[model samples]
Target chain A: MRTERIGDRGDLHRLAAQGLLYRTGPFVIRLQTRLREVTDTFARIYLGTEVLEDPRLAHFSVRVTASSPLRRPWGAQSQFWIDDIPPFEPYPRTHAFPLLEWGINWCIGTRAHRYLLLHAGALERGGRALLLPAMPGSGKSTLSTALAFRGWRFLSDEFGVILPGAATVAPLPRAIPLKNRSIQVIRDFAPEAVMGPVFEKTRKGDVAHVRPPHDSLARQLENAAPGWIVFPCFRAGGTTAVRTLPRSEAFTRLAQNSFNYRLLGERGFLDLTALVRACACFSLDFSDLDQAVAVIEDLASSA
Target chain B: MSSHESAALTAWRQPTSVRRFTAEQWTDALWGAGQHRCLARLSYRIEDAGCANACPEPAWDLLTSARYYPNFLQVRVAREIRHLHRILRARGIDFVLLKGGAYLSAGFPFARGRGMNDLDLMVRRSALGEAEAALRAAGLVTATLNDYDQHYYRTWMHEIPPLHHPERGVEVDVHHRILPLTSRLNPAPEIMWADAVALPATPGVAILSPPDMLLHTATHLFYDGAILDGFRDLLDIDSLIATHAIAPDYWSRLLGRAASLELGRPLYYALYFARRILATPIPTATMEEAHARFAPGALVRPVMEHLVTRVLPPRPRAARAAPVSAWLLYLRSHWLRMPPGLLARHLGRKGLRRFASDSPAADWPPP
Candidate 1:
């Protein structure tokens, strides 16, 4: 099922240009593209990721193809497709990397109903998983990436995927995308980490992707048990504090933030109830990344 | 036809045909079945054949997930029906469920994990206004449509514009008749209501009786000319026949119902395509009798056979003839519903509107 990353740059571009099969945490994706921007960015970010040997069964297939030349005179545009159907409109030709990233996320969130998917950033410590679920402007992504760089094994900075009724969370780590002000915060906070180029004026303001730790991809298949659930809210100049949340409140908030909670029905409810009941739930309000990590570190070690 | 594309149908028709599928074969089957919107049905057949556990990773996950989803929606659909049932019953209005909702509530095994776009119900034409008012009062919101569309539906179409229950996220299509009022044939609603049966569990909620159910499925499939979803519609017809075949005199009752309602043409096409495409079982006598009574003229029969043969396969990719078939089918459907002058006027207006393209893709964070 595995082979070393498809040789060097030429081979990578050649295969992906036609079409190539790559494994992404339990699901196999077949990507086809010819654009240099897409191929180059994909190579850099996915260097640690494996491209599968032949005899493949892909859960979803994507093709990032250029849109009509005339549609955008000043800048070329590219559209994302699964099979032959376009799920979203075209993105700037330069911004194809994040388009690919979030396109895969959309497919997983929409189609992968086998697991309960929480809209949370997940990291693992001491064989247990930490989930940071929050609504927009909650500083979850910035905080999760901060934790990952500080020796917490990264699972994902997006989907916290748990198999229904299982105690462990599956690893689906990818490049953590830091948007707007969080981009600069992460750059200053984690100077040692590898980062990708930032594309300006994306739908969500400026965006850049931080390559996950090498160990995260190496142990992508590993699963961790439930340890903590933290809902992080970033408030500039505010004090860093962690308050315990009742399991019931955690379940409700988690479901509201979940990608497919309603779609999974009873199984989602049961699986989530079990996870929340087994874990320590908290709402963290922090302005300083260092203090936030410290508090979460204490909770992780306690579990 | 590609051998890969045939895997799902062959497996569905004969579950034991292939016990294990190679990765490539699985990809082909997945693509084919997905195009038909029969992934859940395919999954059920695989599980029933006892091969689901033996299947490789991701394949099993994909199947179980697709199948489980409809069951989840099934719960929501039932709740929505109950909500609608109470609303209409309190206002002393009687209604019967139309398609998926009826099939689900009527205890048909084929409907177990079937995914549907919207829940459909039909109230008496006399009570349409009152039912609409009661539904609006009950907090079912209809999306804002333009004044022209509002007039078009209320004046010409059999159904009002769809109503969405904001809380449950379910769309309800309240239809007053089986076909459009302007259609070539208006199957009497009173004849249908005579045989409606209250769901055993939901006393006030009702579904069409078996013969009428078969007739409705046939009429909706052929007259609606839903060629894009034709493959799944064929599966529904096949399953309905298979389920009802167990009952004594079922085929004759269905034929008699179609004849009395002047809907024999659609019933004949439904049986013809179901048998040809899905290999649905139809008694020899029944097929012969239907052909004699309702089959099209000699010239048109072969033409239709050519088109449906092209349109109804779950082809891995659409064949060259697909668009031609779909175009003809689209026109046929409109012609079946409206007189020629009205049809032309309606199509011209709708075509003009397409000069302005469809709404843009939804913003991210939602998808």
Candidate 2:
């Protein structure tokens, strides 16, 4: 069967208003919106994603729209709704696309307990996954985007979606959001990267999105087993350093970084423990994006 | 509302019927149950009915993920109760578990996936002061500190303002009665206390008798609960009857208890809708007797049926508000809760506050 990819911006608008279901790894996200910012950016970023024609189960049916049906010209705000329930306050109207991205991520972090959702950036090579689990502002997204340009299949820049029992991860390669300084840093790092309009003064400061390589988005369903876990940190004007981590420490850190570790209870513990035990672990700190990418690539090859 | 999902909601009581559902229909089942906050319970039914394989992989993933939520709630309830138990035990006071907490403590199998946002327990009115002091000393903050809220809970409401456990994020509601004291129908708490059943597993904890439990469920559904969105409460009534009404004498006992408690009206509504909507097995004799004894007057019956049936079925996503009937039912619930004069003053104050803040959707939108 031929897969139906999204067409032009006008075509995207119609499908979204009528409710468009698109596959992103294990999730069938039903997205509906009239906000041009959302539809416009979504069309550009999701070029290779499969849009399901049949009306079926969607993990979330979300709509991005103005707070009120009647728009305010001077200071309009856009809200994100799952079904009819708006989970958060609205953002500035100009920030609709970013709000849509964050809104869907919120749905996954809060509800998708079918997998062990690690708060990490993941990329695959030779059917083996390298996990870059880190806290926010630690250069996880920047490094993952850099790696994708360097021939690694991007799994996700926000989530390491590990299916329990099989201990394998399916791809969740949504757009990689580059915040603050990471924006210019990625442009310099990957000159040919496809980028979206940057919204000024978001909660996380100036933000833009870089679509993952077309190759990664095309092979989103290919699953990979955990082969390495690297906790990365970025510090300006500092030298590169790498240190191996013990299994026990890795297990604790990974669990702490999970979105639903406690909610999954015993099952989460077992999945995390098995993942840590099966993979080699390390912590890498680098001042340079190029150096950080090189160290990760070396680790990927050695593993 | 006439979509496949709305149609799927009609078969919610029969899990075996899931076998006939296509992948799309299973998706519909998930949305309705999720909207009602009954996903975990439906998951159990799917498994129990031996129809797990019939559920599509997509729907099954969500149902499986939903398991951890109620499981998390069960754990939180147990921890919070343990904290309360130690404090109240030091004061030589016992609390009667109500609703979700009661079902959980009693080990009811159907309660496995039930979600409880707050802990509900009842104590004698005299012990209210002592219970408040103990909880404060235990470091559970009183979330309702504003003068109006405090007055509302202390002076007239059935439960005092909720006490928040800062660590677990669970609030506790300590009740002296099932309905507001100022409400039109105030069942005697001492009478319920006389028949509370003690649990050996958790000493000093007891649940309402089965008959009282049914009536309480009915009253809570129609009288106190948020109107137009009591599908879960209806499911509770069905589950309660299925579990406890096995004995031949249960119906007679339930109806008799409703009379003694002056709760016949709520019970009539409960049984009427439970039968019509879910096809719950109510003995024909009980239905006839209930209608004769407690059915609403002719004028009110059609109005209530019109409003309730419209609201109970899940509305399609496009319709934002319930018909004007919603505001009417909401106002009716308040009217049922307190005398008209007091309700007028209270709603007047609240209406002004809503106008002030520009209602951000809601602080609580159903479940």
Candidate 3:
């Protein structure tokens, strides 16, 4: 059998024509790109993952390539495509890898209504999941990455995929996108963390991706019941403060943080209510990574 | 219909076709339904038949994703209607919801996948300005348009230029009449509201009466020319017929209402095409009467048949439509929309503006 990994083949034309399927969670994205950086980035981040065979229909067929130089020679651009149609304006050529990552995220966030998709980071301990729901710049990613490298298995750094009509969350562990200073934070916090090359000067300034541990990738099929919900906030120099949140307040905050909460209508309301009822909810404010990790670990153990 | 053509349509009209669908056939049907923007309706139809459990992965994926947006819109439309009703009740502006808003308000089966670009509500022309003021006070404002465009809408269009909520991104179109004021056949708005039916869910909102609703749908499709939504409109007609034709006197009432509205010709075409294309059940006597009373002249009838059939169904993925047919219908729509002198001025100005815009850019770094 031909192995799922790309192995040694790195030719752009051949990859685009043949198509490479990267299975992520419930979705298998058939990605085709003529940009060298995008293929290289995909190869690096999705290092040990299986590549699905040809002729199997993918959930999303996407591509990224350079914009025509003749149109605008001043600045090179790369466009992301979904099913042959570009849904967004082209970005600078150096942003192709992030563009691809974001485009796939967009595809899942918009299309996958079978689950209640929250814009939150998730981690698992002893088959129990912890949902860290917060808006951007809330340090959810930083804490989740630290926990993933420490003892907890990473479920996902972006989406908290809670299956509709159930409380269990399916693991979709992919690369953790570390932004700006957090890139160095993770490197120093967990010296064993394997990360990719940093790409700077693009949107979401100075980003790199941390490779998910081999054990997390090995157990991608595992589904864990959500045990706790933490609303994390990072203050630069504040002491650690954790408070129990009322279930009703947690439900409202979670729905506000979800991508498809309103889209799922009554099903979303009922499912989220059930999830909030099952899990212990908290609001944590901390400045130190070690303190935040220790507090979260204690909470998970008590739950 | 050819055997190949019937494969897709058959899948749409009957649920059993889904049970027997090969993987390729299922993929093609899903693709065709998506192209026609009727996947939500297809989802409901298949689920009703208990075929959802057996759907192939690709079909299941398409159906679930397709169903969510329409369901979301359904909730939004309801909320928007309630907001509008609260705002307009004190002003005594009686408004009747139309199209998707109407179907959803009345809880019709065809409302399943009927996504709408705007919420359409028709008020009496005398009350139009008050209704506009009410919507404005409720935070719905019109998009900024140049003077000439504003003049065109205020002077000739049936509705005020569309209103949109700035923060919510929800569009609401308030209409005083159904057709454009300058169209060849103008149905009086009073006749429609005369027999309107109130929606039980909301106090102030109503829908056109059953017969008037059918006539309005046919006139809108035939006269306004809905190319992208042609299939959905036909499906709507089929659903309407199926829902309402059980009354013993419905056919005669429908014909009489169409005649009274000066819309017999459009109704005749709607019935003819609905029956032929979708296998919509039409009584033999009704079909015979429509043919005798409202069939077009020989030359126009054959030309319309060729163009309508070719252009109506969602074009299959591998198929190509005849360009001349679409072009002829385009001209026909404009001709039906306005008189010759106004048509010439409108087309001339539009063409000149398009030409000018297509010319080379003046310089880089646009202000």
Candidate 4:
């Protein structure tokens, strides 16, 4: 049996070996081993103690404890139990991956106290950022991965942290975790995409992370004005198509998809409305990655 | 005795004001004795007040320990819910309170510990005009809105701008449907009306049934990535599950109810999260049964897991996994509530608008 543990003392070294660490201010995350499973962008994750479990968090801090070495159904084997503990406290004696994704989201969302932390995934090109806001399985990661592979700079695969008083998306170049078939799809589509080892059968099916493109990493400090807001849908057999949406509908959707819109309240509403007002909004449906890529390329070239 | 002294003695002689009679100088003694009972009565009034004292000491202790601004907002909102309920009921516009306020009034002990903001109420959509009128009559007015904004609400949106009571100063959002107007799933108001459970505190005021209540809670959280105060919402789910004795057929009934109303996906998300976090009494086989009716995508499971684990508050080892599990129940409820077609429409409509260029109407996507 393989054990999975979060916040285990030895997990740090293991994560470091996996090249998941990326320093942004005082935070760092253990990038999931399989980066290619999610996106083509270079992504890093910070593993931390689950200090507080509030529903508003992006991820939960969890500790899993296994009685002995256990093998995950997805194929990664572990020998640890995971136990979640309060944030800032010492790691408990559990032997599981002490995840810090949601905990970090809460920290940034609340503690950052300056910028509004959004839930949409963001990518940039030519100093222009496009936010891909959708519910899970909307092919957001797949689209973001495809775009990054095609030379678009990866701002973030998970969050679009809009800086205060600016319309630009501050780059938080983190690993995008792709799941199940998305892993194989991205691998076949972007052959040169550098991906970490796959962690199987833990949760969310077999999961992998994709490294952000080097260009995106290089421009991590840069901020890009939001130029486009597209909601991508991956229909199994649908033909590729892009349709424009109305501002009112877009405003509602963005607000709904937004992580901090309500927190931003009037400001969130104003900023999001202005963003949609200024940007070209669209709905893209594609069964083929190449077709979707082509459409985005065309859209970018035209913009 | 002189008139002034006589009046003072008379005032002091009242039994309610004479509890602390052994004070200093006569004037000081009178004031202290008179004020002590008033202060005590005020304290007693606050203690006996609706839902204000509903929170447990530990939760209050935890909240005060944190100097975070949002924490203050959380407690203030909880207190406001108690106050808002009293005022709304006094006006005779019966309300089926949703989420935090409902849970607190449902005899759930943990309601006090749960974090919440913005009181949610469900009123008949037909009565929207009357409801708005009543709210205004009771001093709760809509937030400021420009002409275009008012048109948008009246024309496009499902509900009006959140209402704020002048006296209570708490924002209250009166909702008809869980999702926006464009969403495909529209659970019939009659079903909500049928399953409407009366509040224990106020007989005239009723709430959505347990399943419906869970469904609504999930829809609210999953449809929009609840960013601002999601932690509080998660806690509400935890408390609801911990207190309610949800039946085995609850999932099926919820799914059936959602299907009847066309709210599939929203219910699925709700049930999925409720089960994952709170580990609410939902049987796995039942969950599978429910999922068969409203099959979620492969991506949803992992995302659900990620979300449940992510949002659940950190607790000690002895703390039950009920909160995480309860979230899954709501996820199931959300899935059943909003089917794929509706999810697609919502996504499509939203995408077109956000990505549309200057030619708004010309570029509008077909629903």
Candidate 5:
């Protein structure tokens, strides 16, 4: 009988390689990978029989160990062995990282006293957080990636943790996962951005993660008051324009797009309503990234 | 003391006695054998609880089985309702609670353990001003609409523009009627007033009678064709009936109540579907009698069949047939939910409202 243990940093690394242990907050994640291959880039995760409980501790700790390498033609597949766990079944393929991140978010979100975890990419500039929340393909990630590169301090690439009680956005910055052609686009645009190796064809086509600038990482503990709520739509070849939307309409749109708005029920509604009331809202339609980034920067600077 | 004595002596040499364990004891022993299996298998996991804190063993363990999402939501909604009640009372405006909050106040447990979407309430037509003002005073901002549109909502729609609280992020739909913007079954608002019962669980928040609540749930499910997270609502109806043990006479009283209130259509739809889908124990004779009086068979059967197909369509497949069939079923269901006459009237009114807004006569009374 294989018994898993959570002892030290080395043990944590060993378990992470096996795909059985997940680290939450200092970051948030919902990781599920097999440990078939091990490398500097990929560690083999192991499964262990351990139950850890600590409040001031990060959310979610499951032990796993690395096994052997999973062979793939495109690249050496670094696999983590996740024993006694279920296989990874993610939607759109590349969504594995986001799903894991969301799971970690669920952990911390469930514990907060005043903040609510919202599904949106948050970025801070000039002491204010600009929330870009939208459904998939709504160009939120792309816009967030662009804005972060252009010096809008990245608060989070996913999840806008709205602290309506304090009227602020708490920062939980981590690796921003960019998918498909957008990956290359960001790489070319930034030129100096630190990004992870591109993993092809697991889920959510051609996925890669870009590490936030060191400055942004350093400021991860900083909080920004939410200043603007923008619903971004990416239309190829369309002119970039920002239109002020009615607060009421924006409220409705935000409610509809939220993952746990209904789950939070009346409080969720009231919290979101307060958030929109305190913030200016707009609908931005743009095909050009540079123009969008400039307008966002200007907006942030003004705020 | 021959062969038997020899055997007994051999058994005694091994052990004096071997206790035979019962099935229950054996099960307990088995469970105790595993290291973490007992702890892991102690409770069923709720997939959508939305808590991620897997530390602070006691807190994490409590949250793991705590029904925290709905419980947290219930507390939040209760607080908001208390605030809303204060505002309404301060202004001397009367209000009636509806749906989830209403159910909670009536001790129905907030949509059978699932969180509700928004707080629903009804204010009298004459007191819309007082109600709106009260909500505004309570920090709920009303959505600004164009003057004409605002007038339309006030005049024809069942509710005012949903009022939102800035910090709470909750929407409150203040309604004057129970049905659609264009439904023929216009029940008198006063009827709900007569049967309205104060929530036993929460003071100042009034809930509809069991029969009315049941009818409301059914009408909502059948008429609106809005079935997002409706399984929870259906479960509400089931629990309400089972717990109340509502009598057979209740159905007849409901039918009479519907007729007097001029809500025959909504009532008929509710009873029909409640019996069909939920297997609510209404007497067959009552259904048959109502069927004869309402004569809904001509329209109801096809509508129900269409809805049944749409709501529970065949599983998706690789073949084109499945997709095509689903599309057709969806169209059919939409048509059934709204008859051609109602649909035509709705579309026509919408078009007229959009294109021509100068004439006061253009504003038609709600169907």
Candidate 6:
């Protein structure tokens, strides 16, 4: 089906007034945001993703709006609401775009328990995806974005969504948020990358997003089997080091890095164990994005 | 009063009512279920009614997501129970699982989609210290409530202030009895424990016997706590009755158990509301006997009936509860749980603390 791709400012505002049903791979989001920055950033970064004119289902209905004047004056604060429930206090209005991204992530992390969600960035090559599971500020997003430009299909920069009881990985393929130094770092590294306006002083420091590769966004529905699990860390001025992670340690670390590991219980154990067994696990520490991409490419060839 | 409400109530009572639901009515039913926090149960009901295929894709999707969390919690609850039993059994302490824990452990149909925030268990009053110690030794700490709050819980409440497991991230409520010690009605722990039934599959854990379960659910719903969005508990009563009321002597035994536990009034309200609202099947004779023997005074009964109609159903997000009715119900709940003097002291202290510690203007949207 040919779906609308939210393009014009007037259309964006009109849809925001009425809820916009936006599809992101397996999940559908009904989003409403009056904030121009949010809508504008979404239009730029979410290009090529289908916007269902009228979707049959939306997993989440979310809104990002200004806080009451009594609490904070207009344009000073914004609240992220899901089904009228605000999970967190309001963020500054300037941070509306990032707040919406984080809020949508929160909804998926909490509600989409049907999939075993790993807090990882994923990219596919040769029909198998390499999962980069790491903590925040470990440069997962930066590495994922770098690889997406290096001929790897970006599955997701935020989540490695594994279908239940399957080693196959589904692509969320949303925009890769570039945080703080990574914003300028990505700009310098991939000059061709479409970057959104940077929102200064977000909760995560200066934040902007890189538009997902058009090819990856076009093939968002594509799924890949597990090929390798690479736990990567970016260290300043450090020699590039790659070590084979033990299966047991990989299992434990993967569980820890999962969003719904405990919630999935034995199912999580089975899936993670299967994933660890099926994949070649490694821990890579690199100082250079080019070197990191080189190491990952070398690892992918063997897979 | 609205057809949306009527449709929801009708669908809840007889799942076949789903066949007649228009798009708006179906959405309303979903909203009602979500508002009452029973969407999971509704999913089960829809499937049972064979309306799963008939329902809109969005409703089923929402239901699937709703059921997902509860299923997730169910597995965790089982693991937590197993761990707790391993610890408590070493001390020779046998505990009765309460509420959601009991429902899940006992494998009730209603347990399928029930979301649980914590695991509640009642040990013998004499063993309270030992159980608390056991939990503490296992690395669960009591919440760092203020001195006044701690004092109040220890002094008057049936359960200690909630305990938190730092690693597991689950709350555990340890109760030594059912009702407040100083309340006008004290349902003895012995009576409940005496009739409690052991979960066959989950050995070493027990739940209140069928009749005592209903009474305790009733007492908790109508007497023990703030009834904020408690329509779910009321559904528990209806489901329990629907499942167990088929036994030849269920109603008689329920009434007898309620009397023995000094929970006749709660049981009466439970039966009244369950039948009046959800159309739960109760023997006419039992309802009449409960009405005659345990009904409130004429003036009080009329007022309660009015307020209950307002408060029992799920309210729309935009609609406020009838403020006066809600406040009166709140006072009644407190009065039933605590004596007059203690109630005043407790409410006054808590009110003042709330006023003083009010979040810096930003906490405008209270959960």
Model-by-model DockQ, in order: 0.65, 0.67, 0.36, 0.01, 0.06, 0.32
The number of clashing residue pairs in each candidate reads 0, 0, 0, 139, 57, 0
Docking class of 5: incorrect
Model 3, B1-367: lDDT tens digits are 2435734576777877777776546645766776677888888888878888887675677677778888888778778888888989978888999988888888888688777767989999999989899889888888887787788788888889988778766688888988888899989899999899987767777999989889888988888756424788888888899878998989999999988888988999999999988889999999999988888888888888988888787655457655676666777777888889998998787767667787632221111
Q: What is the TM-score of chain A alone in each candidate?
A: 0.96, 0.96, 0.95, 0.71, 0.74, 0.95
Q: What is the lDDT of candidate 2?
A: 0.85
Quote fnat for model 3. 0.38
Interface RMSD of 3: 2.5
Interface RMSD of 5: 11.3
Q: Give the better candidate number (2 or 3) by DockQ.
A: 2
Report residue A242 deviation for candidate 6 (angstroms): 2.7
lDDT of 2 by residue, A1-303 (tens): 787887533588888888889988788898999877788898899986778876677888889988664656578899999967899998998899999999999999999998989999999999899999999999999999999988888899999999987379889999889999889988998899999998899999998999888888888888999899999988889999998999998888888898999998878888888899889999999989778888887887786
Native contacts kept (model 4): 0.00
Docking class of 1: medium
- DockQ, candidate 4, comes to 0.01
Error of 2 at A267 (Å): 2.1
Error in Å for residue B185 of model 5: 1.8
lDDT of 1 by residue, B1-367 (tens): 3463456677677665545667766776777777677888878877777877766776777777787678877888888988998898898888899888988878788886688778999998899999999999999999988887898899988899999879888899999898888988779999998889987776666888888888888888788656545777788888888887899989899899899889899889988888887789998899999999999999999998987877677764433336767667767777888999988897777766665655442221111
Off by over 4 Å in 6: A8-10, A68-71, B6-11, B14-31, B48-62, B67-95, B123-141, B145-147, B160-172, B188-190, B198-206, B316-324, B355-367
TM-score of chain B of each: 0.92, 0.94, 0.94, 0.60, 0.66, 0.94
Where in model 5 is the C-alpha error above 4 Å?
A1-303, B1-66, B109-112, B144-152, B200-205, B264-278, B298-303, B309-367
Interface RMSD of each: 1.3, 1.5, 2.5, 19.0, 11.3, 3.2
Q: lDDT per residue, candidate 1, A60-109, as tens digits?
A: 88899887778667778888998678899889888888898989999999
- Model 3 spans > 4 angstroms off: A1-16, A69-74, A237-239, B1-10, B22-27, B83-93, B129-150, B163-170, B198-205, B283-292, B301-311, B319-331, B347-367
Local error of candidate 2 at residue B185 (angstroms): 1.3
lDDT, model 5, position A122? 88
The better candidate by DockQ, 1 or 2, is 2
